[model samples]
Target: MISKLNLENILFLDIETVPETAHYSDLDPTKQALWDAKSRYQRKEEYSAEEFYDRAGIWAEFGKIVCISVGYIKMEGEVRQFRVTSFYGDEVKILNDFKTLLNTHYQEQKYLLCAHNGKEFDFPYIARRMIIHHIELPNKLDLFGKKPWEVPHLDTLELWKFGDYKTYTSLKLLTNVLGIPSPKDDIDGSEVYDVYYKTKEIERIVVYCEKDTIAVAQIFLRLRGDQLLQEHEIIHV
Candidate 1:
């Protein structure tokens, strides 16, 4: 099925998120209580809500997107390139800009969005965050009544799962096992909060996110029996 798809029709992406505020105390009393309740099962008795606050970025209600890096295969004058770019800074603007891109360029059924664990994380996270800001859902992200196979989205992790539903694989693990370059050499999801909240290094996170996006595209190519993208072919636009 993948062989029938055009590589240029797919927009590969990854997102970086952080808690809405720098600290737990930064939340209002109502949100603080909500956080405590929402994370009850995950934290259990091992960690308090405040202690688990760093992980709030994993949930859309308690988090905001900081960076959304996207890459797509493009052709220019007989040259093929995987051009990558990022939308960072304000959350609302980040989302609106991405929506514009989808609505303008990738609205067709032929264009699919791909990410590692995207169906589980990146895709839904973006949709939820858009809804939080009252942004209208683009055709690609709006999955209201679409059938499972009708949804024009792809997940490398889901592909990697094949028929096994119980196992989970991180992007780092997949890239390593597949002989692709590691995107986690600098920072990972766990340290994103500290990097954004403490150091204010958004560009650093943007680079990390773009690497993951490229890695997603590479994984798809590999799964389809194509060559891994060379460094010279990856362009940061």
Candidate 2:
């Protein structure tokens, strides 16, 4: 299936999320209690809910997406150009804009959404957030009645798993093995919350998200036994 895919038909994407609020105290008392109960097992007495709030972005219920960067391959003359664009700011606005992009350009059976660990994280997170915001799910994202094989999505992390369900691979590690440049040179996922809430540098997060999307595309290409894209070949749209 990987080899048969048309690269241009796949929209490769990555998302950046932060806790719903800058501090745990910012949440209402009711939400604070809910968070405390929700994180009990994960915290395991090592950290309180307030201390663990930094990691809230991983959970769809307590976090909001700040950026959704997407890229698609385009053939230009003799080069393969990967074009990237991002929808960011106010979670609802970001989600609405992203849905617009999907409705406008990717509303086709042949089009597929690709991401690293997307099935578990990015894909569901987007769907859950959309529901929270009362936004309609795009055809590609709404997976209610579709058969397993009919789902039009690709996950690089799932591809690397190769049926070994016990092991997990980070995009950084996979890209390193595949000889793709590291997308973490500036800041890693852990620092995104700080950069967003403290520095207010959403553009930096957007750049990071775009690089991850590009890396996902490059990794897919490498898995297909194709050459990795050159820096000059990536076009930011």
Candidate 3:
């Protein structure tokens, strides 16, 4: 139960990423000239979109992070209140800002880091980028050398062990099963890059990240036997 968890010590985060470039061919390369003439920025030397999907890193076609959303919650008496702090900027800036917040606030003992699919994607991506930028990760996020289940990681997706191992389900699907309202209004994972680049609107990405965090929170509440906030109870923490 999250009620037994040290609420003040835990932090939840989610990230939105986009493809770096679209130059590689899934088929035979017909244009040696096109590949040579393209600017270094446009050239993706490490990985392609397919490879990105598999490898799951900065090299992945999702070149950079457009938004990083952090949700902090505490048991304020009998009620659990939450505050969402979203960071939006260039890749470095967003990562740096997030690191700064973690250093200032969550750098402590016995703090469990929670995220949806974090064990697989979000946590690793952030840690890799942070290391690339020479930023020191907080104690809670220092999960590089540990085994997947060995680390102090809480993934709601993993918690829902109720489903068959072959039947992978989305957070949205789990939310639906739990009777939680879907907050998936903004662009989805597919449109992440286009939305971030075309509109340069991090707010939309922020909302998307926020919805995921809130969904995770709701999922946590359900698992912990806490009262899930209704439509009207969503007053900002």
Q: Over the stretch 1-237, how does candidate 2's per-residue lDDT look in tens digits?
A: 699988889999999999999999999999999999999999999999999999999999999999999999999677788899999989999999999999999999999999999999999999999999899899999999999999999999999988889988999999999899999999999999999999999989999999999999999999999989898988998
Q: What TM-score does model 3 achieve against the real structure? A: 0.76
Clashes of each: 0, 0, 3
Evaluated at residue 23, the lDDT of candidate 1 is 93
Kindly report which residue stretches of model 3 are placed more than 4 angstroms away from their true locations once superposed: 1-3, 21-62, 144-150, 162-165, 231-237
lDDT of 3: 0.68
**Model 1: pairs clashing at backbone N, Cα or C within 3 Å:** none
Ranking by lDDT: 1, 2, 3
RMSD values for the candidates in order, in angstroms, are 1.0, 0.8, 6.3
Please give the lDDT score at residue 34 for candidate 2: 97
Q: Least lDDT summed over 10 consecutive residues: which range in candidate 3?
A: 53-62
- Name the better of 1 and 3 by TM-score: 1
Can you tell me which runs of candidate 2 are displaced by over 4 Å?
none
State the C-alpha lDDT per candidate.
0.95, 0.95, 0.68
Clashes of 2: 0
What ordering of candidates by TM-score runs from best to worst? 2, 1, 3
Question: lDDT by residue for model 1 over 1-237, one digit each (tens)?
Answer: 888998899999999999999999999999999999999999999999999999999999999999999999987877889999999999999999999999999998889999999999999999999999999999999999999989999999999999799999999999999999999999998999999999989989999999999999999999999888899999999
